[model samples]
Target: MNLEEYIKENTATFDAFLQDFLSINLTNHSAKLLEAMNYSLLNGGKRIRPLLVMAFAQNLDIKKEYYMNVALAVEFVHTYSLIHDDIMDDDDFRRGQLATHKKFDIPTAMLAGNSLLTWAFQILSDESTHPNTEVRNYLTGFLSSSSGHTGLAYGQSLDLEYQFGNKNADYKKILKMHDLKTARLFKFCTRAPFVLCNPKILLNNKKTEHLDIFGTNFGLIFQATDDLLDYRDLDKSVDLGNIMSYKNNDEVVNYCKKLAKEALASLKNLEIDSQVLTELIQFIIIRKS
Candidate 1:
């Protein structure tokens, strides 16, 4: 299948898998929290992180049901970030629908986000996620560190700092924030599969290092393009993160192209097929929503 078709088919399959995996019952006392969590998780998204997980796994020739645990874990963390981010950014809409905080109460949204974040580790800790206990432990620790205080959370802290005018939006600080807030998770997406499968060639520090580089640059490209789109569809109240605030529209676009080139170069160094990943770069640059 072509890249677009491949994405669509895989996305459909993943969504179905995610729905069944959640399998929440509404009769419980915490039903509202469950509903809010489900709403945020199943809400419209590009599913780019999970797609990366699946694509890398497939390219490694290690496709298996356990890989879905990795994919879902990544997405759960991502979704949790978005829900909490919306509340912090005071965004009323998410994916063209009401934000979780708006649809549910702020406390409910907060709990939902917390649950999703914790749920990611819970999923990874399950023996079903990996037969090897060491592998499961590694996955859990990797995910936690990536999304924890030194990673995505740290990035968001930087973003909020800049947003409230507490810090100047210099190019260096902006880039650092982008790396933390956005690219760190992408790093997880790219590196997790190799670590998951424990493939010899990919498992080496040097090779997985390149994958981490690719994921970071790829995520920067995604974030840069998103900034461009935000400029196109500028909302007066919402901050466009730091990129737009630091660089002009044309400069941001050029930086995106540069990041794509760097990311593709990293992919070229890897043993996997990169056709879909290359197309994904183009897709990110051209996507409207």
Candidate 2:
């Protein structure tokens, strides 16, 4: 299938999966907390991160059921990050709706975010996620490191520091922050399939290294596009003083295209058909949202 068609089909399946996976008993004492969590978890963002996991796994002949929880774990971590990020950034809206903190109280939103973060690991650790205990442990470690202090959290910290303390932050510093904050998780999304099927592939295979590099570029493209979109939304001229040092919209767009090309190139050595991944790279650059 074509990329758009593939994404449409998988997005529907993943959304349905999320609905059932996130369902909580209304009569429970923490029903309100569960409600807030569900509100944000079910928010209609393009499920790109989870889709990446599935896309990468597909090439390895992995069944969707085998990797479904892994994909969901990525989404949960992503959602948790969003909830906390909205709170920290004091953002009122997300995906064109009230952010978790705004929809619910700050404390409720915080707890929901925390709960999702914890549950990501919980899902990774569950026996139903994978038959092999070693594989589950590997995934647990991978998810933890990707979302914990050295990965997403570190990136967020750098971003906050730059926004509040380092008005003169340069392009390199900003890129490092983005890599940690954004690219690390994408790295996991793309590479974890290898870890699941054969952990040694990641350790010894050159193609696996290429996949990791692809994810790194993908993450950069995702974040750069976001910055460009934000600039467009604000009707602001491109400013070098901004977090990224792009001189104009063309520069940002060109950079995204460059990253997409690099990402596509990285898949050249893989034996599997990677048309969906190639299209995804292209889609990342052109996506409006």
Candidate 3:
């Protein structure tokens, strides 16, 4: 089975779901900043995070449209991070389009990012969104861990502080930065669906442990890919240039591939479809900037 072809088949579903969640609902006067938020959030790109949410859910036999909401919530969180990253870096373009701040103004873009970030929590906290309150709560808790002190925002803070001659920085510090900055949330993505699949909730404790392990490895692979992409774009001057301290782009990709193998191996006892999971691994290693 062609993974690309399978992705194509699922593209429409992802797109439709994205549109509904990101639809420009707030009036312009109510929050003109929302326009810029919507602009960046709705910008054309591969919806990989959301796809991961649904794909993992499907792999576990938890088939339901409710996964759509969870997936979109993940996307919203990711987009909010990107918007803030652009503003903090004073970036001009994102995915070949004007960054949120550039499209509107700095304050507007910042507010927009804030709005999206909070919206993610709102969606996740809504018990009605998913039948399994355990799943919803598990995801929300992990997201909370990933979004704040334990995750991206916390990681970003340390990264910025390191840049301004915070002399105590070291490889471990950078590694922690990568974990919280890029990897932690991905760990949340890969493992959260398992929480949703606890039919009798008998596997709750064991599955939570298993999922945590899976998420950590998955997070490493994902962060390594980001490093690889930046290393490749060295000529183009892209990448955050911190946390992922690789020797070069080739090393970054190889590291990511190796880490992905370890992560995939952790699932060997499971009965997940090999072909689909293999394709995911390929995407992790060979993705372009």
As a TM-score, model 2 comes out at: 0.93
lDDT of 2 by residue, 1-289 (tens): 8888999999998897777676542245468898887888888978999899888887786766667888988998999999999999899999889999999889999999999898888888888777888888988898888888989999988888776746667888888888988999999898778777776775676877788889899998898887777777773543434444444688888888888877777888665567888889888888888
Q: Report the candidate with higher TM-score, 1 versus 3.
A: 1
Model 1: how far residue 35 lies from native, Å = 1.0
Please list the C-alpha lDDT of all candidates, in the order they appear: 0.85, 0.83, 0.71
lDDT of 3 at 282: 67
Off by over 4 Å in 2: 24-30, 235-245
Error of 2 at 272 (Å): 3.1
Clashing pairs in 2: none
TM-score to true structure, per model: 0.93, 0.93, 0.86
Clashing pairs in model 1, backbone N/Cα/C closer than 3 A: none
Error of 2 at 138 (Å): 1.1
How far in Å is the alpha carbon of 36 misplaced in model 3? 1.9
**RMSD after CA superposition, every candidate:** 2.2, 2.1, 3.0
Q: For each of the candidates, give the backbone clash count.
A: 0, 0, 0
